[model samples]
Every structure is written in C-alpha cells, then in structure tokens.
Target chain A: MKVNKYITIYKDMVRQIESGQRKAEDVLPSENDLCDQYGTSRETVRKALNMLAQNGYIQKIKGKGSVILDREKMRFPVSGLISFKELSETLGKETRTTVHRLGLILPPSEAAKELGTEADEKVWEVVRSRRIDGEHIILDKDYFVKKHVPLLTKAICEDSIYEYLEGELGLSISYAQKEIVVEPAGEEDRKYLDLGGFSHMAVVKNRVFLEDTSLFQYTESRHRLDKFRFVDFARREK
Target chain B: MKVNKYITIYKDMVRQIESGQRKAEDVLPSENDLCDQYGTSRETVRKALNMLAQNGYIQKIKGKGSVILDREKMRFPVSGLISFKELSETLGKETRTTVHRLGLILPPSEAAKELGTEADEKVWEVVRSRRIDGEHIILDKDYFVKKHVPLLTKAICEDSIYEYLEGELGLSISYAQKEIVVEPAGEEDRKYLDLGGFSHMAVVKNRVFLEDTSLFQYTESRHRLDKFRFVDFARREK
Candidate 1:
C-alpha cells in the first residue's frame, strides 16, 4: 500500500520528538528549508506541519515557525477508539491490569438500554482497575452482549478483550460513539479505584459497534480526576 | 457555493430529528430505499447515514437499518471551535452571560506560559459566568494577548468576544488545541457558579490561534459536573 508523502514526514517528525531529538519550545525549520530538505513542495511540508500541530506535537507561531509543545501529561486522544492495553503499550510505562470481577449476568437497566438487549438477555460484565506506577487511577466497567460475544473469561479480561474479539473470534470491530462527562465517584469506583482525596471522576462512556453496525459492547471508564487529561486538535469550521 | 449532496441530506436529517419529525428509536429507511427517495446512489445515501450516525442522531443495526438515538442531554461536539454564543444559539436555550470582571493586566503565570508571553507583556482578563435557565452552570476565564486585541470592553465581553474580534477587529479565528480535565472546584468556581452539592468541575482549557497561526487567547471554561457532556464519533485507525 502506498502511503502519503506528508504522512511519512509527519511520522518522522513524531519520531524525532518522541526520541528527544526535538525538545520542547524548539522551533522547527522553515517551511522552505523543510521543502528543500525533503524534496517536497511547500504545500506538502505545511500539510505535515499541520498534522503535527493538530496532534499536539507542535504549536505553529505566525513568524517563528512551529515550536514543540511540552508534553508532560499523557495525551488521551478524544477521537480514537483505542483500548486500554493499546494505550498502556504506547505509554511505555509500568502498567498492570487487575480484573476485579467477571461474570455472565442479566444486563443492568442502563447497560440493557445501551446494548439494546431484550428481557432475559444476558451480558458479560467485566470490571477492572488499571494501575500505573503503583497508583490505581482508572476503573473500567464493561458489558458485552452475550449473544455476540458468546463467551468471556477472567484471563481474557486481564489481557485485551479487543484482541480476543477481533483476532480469535474474527469480529470486525469498526466505529464507536463516546461521551465524556464528570460525575461524582460512585460506590463501585471507591471500591475498585484509589480515590485518595478526589471526590469526582471523569467518566468516558463508550458504545462499540461491529463492522455490520451492531452495538456489541458498552464500556464506562472512570478515571481519577487528577490522572485524566484529554487532548484534541480542532480546526475552525467554515 | 455548491454543497455536497450528502451534506444536504445530512442536514435535512438533522432538521427532521430536531423538529420531532423523526422520533427516537424510529428506524430510518434502508440504504436502498433512501437512495431511491433521494435520487442518489447507495454510496451517497450511505455517506449521509454515516454522518447521521457519527453525530449521535442515529445508530445503525446490522439488518434493522438505522435507529434514532435519544438526545436528552445536549450533545457537545468535541472537535469544534465554537463560541459560547454560537452554541447557545444552536441550543435555542435561555442563556445569559454575566461579565463579573474584565481588565487588562500582566498575564498570570499559567496564562503567560500558555500564551507564550514574554516579560512585561499584558493580557486582557475576562471572567464571565454563564446562566442557563437562571442557574449558573459555567464559568469562563479568558486571557487575550493585548498586543493583538488592542482593546476590549465590558459590553464586548458580555456579548461574544469572538464576534467582536472577528466582526469588528477583522481578526480571522482559525483553530484551537483543547485539553479537558476534571479538577477540584476552585474558590472562584464556588463563588461564581451554582455548585449545588458537587465539589468538582470539568475544565476545558483552550488555546486559540488565528489564521496567521499565532496563539492569541487562552480560555478555561469550567462547568458543573452535571451540566457537562461531550460527544465524539471516532473511527478505528487501521
């Protein structure tokens, strides 16, 4: 498959930033210089720079060129359907997942509504807590339509259910609709997470659909307020 | 100006949903049926349907077509650079903005860092509270680089600064990078907003840029937890 030239440039720049070759507040080369260096047009270099800016890698200054942004907090992309395992891998930090509970039970009212399950339909409920550097910061509650998922185990929940669902079960995971809201920490959150002095948590509600567009899973990820940060790049709508 | 057929279809569907012509859980016409009704190809119809699904208007099921989604909470788009005035107008809600404070002063340490201001640089600080149906739900703290803005008034602050900046100042608002996090409600938040019993708030920190790619403004919008909702549609990146 042929990749776009601008994407290649974007990836190389990201590598440089991530590898510490490009430090924060460092201004990038001029567009003309980049164009000549990459043997690409000015438009192409700008495209790459735009992508960098959009992803929070750089800030474009009017006359000073693009400056690298300080990336202290882990950036959770607001527009990606990434799994916790994938996210942990990308962070390259010491992470562990603890499966608190795994069971096949009648769907809760809210989960039933979200999954569109009929009466007497069962769903797989999985609860897990994520620990990074000995700090428990995230509590995930997941429900899967038993009719679609069929079977789930604690071991699978400990790993990545998405990997099993897609690789083993041959399910074509497609798109998702996500809603983020701040809510008071519930009793379950207190039990599964290290709340410390925080009284509220950021809740990310996600409904995942298969390629055929069937809603198969509903997940609520609760994160400790201080540990949660979502970054988004937005273009002005004309 | 020529609008894409799919966008026209998408807008029409949004109007139908908003006007109550289409009810929640109501199944939309099948792709082939929509193609025939709109005199378009299946691909075009699918694009329109996709947009509808993406915007939380509908959910597509494997064999049952698309079903309208419940829109009880106001859906806040996560990837748009819209002003509060524009959002309230779209919501058609009784909203009021109270300018609690507006002044030009030396930039605050955090604001200075975010705006990339040098020493001795001044910024216009505007603090406003948003009332929806007589309940104070949002508090906005905005800092604008005085060099670019030049002037600001209480009237402009109470109204829409973006409007004044664009319409009067002829500034081209371009893009923004946003960070959403939950934080403990500060003293200012407790004083300005109707917190009820909640002790935390959702903070949306935005750094806005102009068409020239210069960062000119930094805004921190604090919202009551119950009143905050952000919706995003994301596709899986392969």
Candidate 2:
C-alpha cells in the first residue's frame, strides 16, 4: 500500500499527543502552520486534522484551536448488544455505578405499550449514573417488568441488576429493539452528569426482550455526545 | 393483551399530535400537571413525554417546556449508498444542487490513498451546495478518480453527477465504506448553508467502490445536526 503523506502527518500528531509532548489543553498547530510544516496545502492539513478529530484524538473547537483529547475512547457498540457491566469490564476502565433512585412505580400509557403490557402496570424503575475514568459519562433509566425482576431498591440499583436477574433469578434476556437519536442534555441529566448546557446527548431507547421473545425490560441509555462511538465493518463487495 | 394505562396516554398524545389537534411549538402540560391530570406519578408522566420526544413529536428545551415538533422531517437513509439525486428523490423533498466549484485538480496524498491512486494524481474535484426545501443544508466536496470518470465537468456537477456517470459514462457503483460524526459547521458551510452557530453538522465520509471492486470516489456529505437521522438494524440478545 502506498503511504499517504497526510496519514504520516496524522500519525506524527498522534505520537506527539501520546508522548505527552502535547498536553490535553495544548492547542494544535493552525492549519496554515501545519501546511507549512508538512509541505502540503491547507486542504490536506485540514483533512488530516479532521481524521484526528473524528477518531477522538483531538477536539476541534471552532474559532479556537484543536486540543488533544484527555483520554482515548473505548469503542462503545451502540448497534450490537452488550450489558453495561460487560462493556465496562471489557474496556478495563475504572467503572463505578451510582444508584440515584429505584422504586416500584406505575407505568405510563406509552411505556406500557412499549413493554407490551397494560397501562398502570407496576414496574421496577431504576436510575443509574455511570462514571468512567472518573467522569460521569452515562445516565441510564431502566424500567423492568415487575414479574421478571421484582422488589428492586436503591442498593440493588447500585449493583448490576442485569447480573442479579440472570445470575440469581435465572432470567434470560433474548433481544431488544432500540431507537437512537441526538438530543440536548436536559435539566435532570445536567444535575447528575455535569454536562455543559450546550452539550447534546446520544439518546438510545431500547425495548428489551426475554429468552421467550417476551418484552421484559426497557432501558434508555443517555450517552455523553462526545464519548459515544459506533463502528461496523462490511466487505468491499458485500 | 393486558392494557397499560401509560401506553393509552401515549397513544392519546400521539393522536393529538398526528391529528393536528396540537400545533407545532405548543407546550404540553408539565409533568406535575400531567401527574394530576392522568392520576399517574412523575415517572409515568415522563414515560409518555420521552416517547413523544424520541419519535420526533416534540423538542425538550432545558428550563423551557417541551415544544411540539413541526414534523416536516426530511429522512436521509443511513445506508450511505445513494447519489445526491437518488437521496433527494427518496426523501421526496425539493432539493437543488448548486455547483459551487468543479475542476480537474491534483489529489492530495490522503485522497490518493483512499482512491488507490498516486499522490498528486489528476482527480476531478467538485464542490456543490445542497439545498433542501429551499434552504442550503449541506456543502459537499466530492473527489472522483479521474481514471474512472475521464471527462467530468461543472455542468455535470449541476445535476446529479452520479446519474450522468452511470447513465452516460456507464460506470456502475457497487459498494462503499462510510464513517459519520458530528462536526462544527465550517466557514464555507455557514456562509452558503445559512446555518447558525446553534447547530452542528453530521459529516459522512465515504469511500466508493466500483463494480470491479476498485475504489473510485470519495464523498463527504455534511448535514445539519438537527435535521440528520440515522436508522439501522441490530440483532443481539438484550
């Protein structure tokens, strides 16, 4: 494969960042400066920087210069299914769960429809705040069909409820239907996640299924916009 | 099927929106008001509202109440396989393409690598402004392998260059590798697309392959964040 000069420039910048020569808040060289340094046009320089930004190696703040990212991102598979505990474990990151609220609540009409149950159905409501690398990255609100996982509490919420269900209760999860969108962080999210007022969230609505293909749980994964990444592979001829 | 009251409330609200009983920008009742009106808890009330927000029925602004959406959504396929004309046609929305710049230019090193060509290779660079519903929503910069499309021009860029390539030039497109991310609107985009600073752009970068499995085109589709929607299939046990 022919080596691209811009890729060389991109790698060099990555090395600078990884080696701590360029600190997190240090401003990357301007496009014109990079063009002069790399002996390439402004377009080529911008293209290299764009790749860096997309890979989360840098954050390009408009008007301001690009800054090295504080941390490398772990690819969070939003498309495929992975329990929160498993994902955190896979990444080998310091993962902590804080249960803010949990209760037996009456489901609203809309949630009832999604859960394939009746309105006013009693459900286990759990609110969890996930902190990764010491930063609160996700706020999750899960509603479980009471029949599947009954008698939830704040202490149980702090633990992996999915683990308790499948391990202790022997309940099996089958599948889920998820809807993903970009939405702004709301007041409730701001209180827990400390998200900037301008920050948008990657909202995921999932209707979880049981082993028998029954709707058992519904979860909403509100991801910090900058932290969420989804990737997939396809054949060149597929 | 057992009936769920929350779902009943959800359907009722959806009907009100769909039937035009509730106009766009109108605020629904607050959570406290809804709890009393529906005789449900705050969580139950929010359940219905979250559904409304996810399905594009309303916008939740922090501090401000939820505003009903106009529902004039222009859907873009996440497949990333369609040409500009095909995409516009699929959306069934009025879209005009303005050929801002088109010329035979030397490909940058990165473009050459993606195209499987050499650095400084002769390539056709076409810059076009895409207008959806009379508003410029995207500014695209497309690079085509000159070896593939030998005689591309500005006139070709004006109206579905992909159509001209397939119909007249007779080069069949087969597959593509696409990457998408949120990016701040650039100078050219803000100037031409008339987008304000409040929103970002969904930037899609694709590597197009021909019928022979040869990479031939590189396209960047930048869409306004608020207007962008992505839908895909995922299969995994919850």
Scored against the native two-chain complex, candidate 2 gets a DockQ of 0.10
Cα lDDT, model 2, residue A14: 80
Pick out the ten consecutive residues of candidate 2 chain B with the lowest summed lDDT.
B229-238
- For model 2, the docking class works out as incorrect
Off by more than 4 A, model 1: A1-74, A108-110, B1-74, B108-110
Cα error, candidate 1, residue A27 (Å) = 10
Best by lDDT: 1
Question: TM per model?
Answer: 0.78, 0.58
Candidate 1 structure quality by residue, lDDT tens digits, B36-97: 98899997888789767755678788877898876654366644688999888877789999
Model 2 misplacement above 4 A: A1-76, A89-92, A109-116, A147-176, A209-214, A234-238, B1-76, B109-117, B154-175, B209-214
| Consecutive 10-residue window with the lowest summed lDDT within model 1 chain B | B71-80
Give DockQ for candidates 1 onward, in order.
0.49, 0.10
What is the C-alpha lDDT profile of model 1 across A69-151, one tens digit per residue? Answer: 76654265544788888888877789999999888888556554678788788988888999989999999999999889998
TM-score of chain A of each: 0.72, 0.63
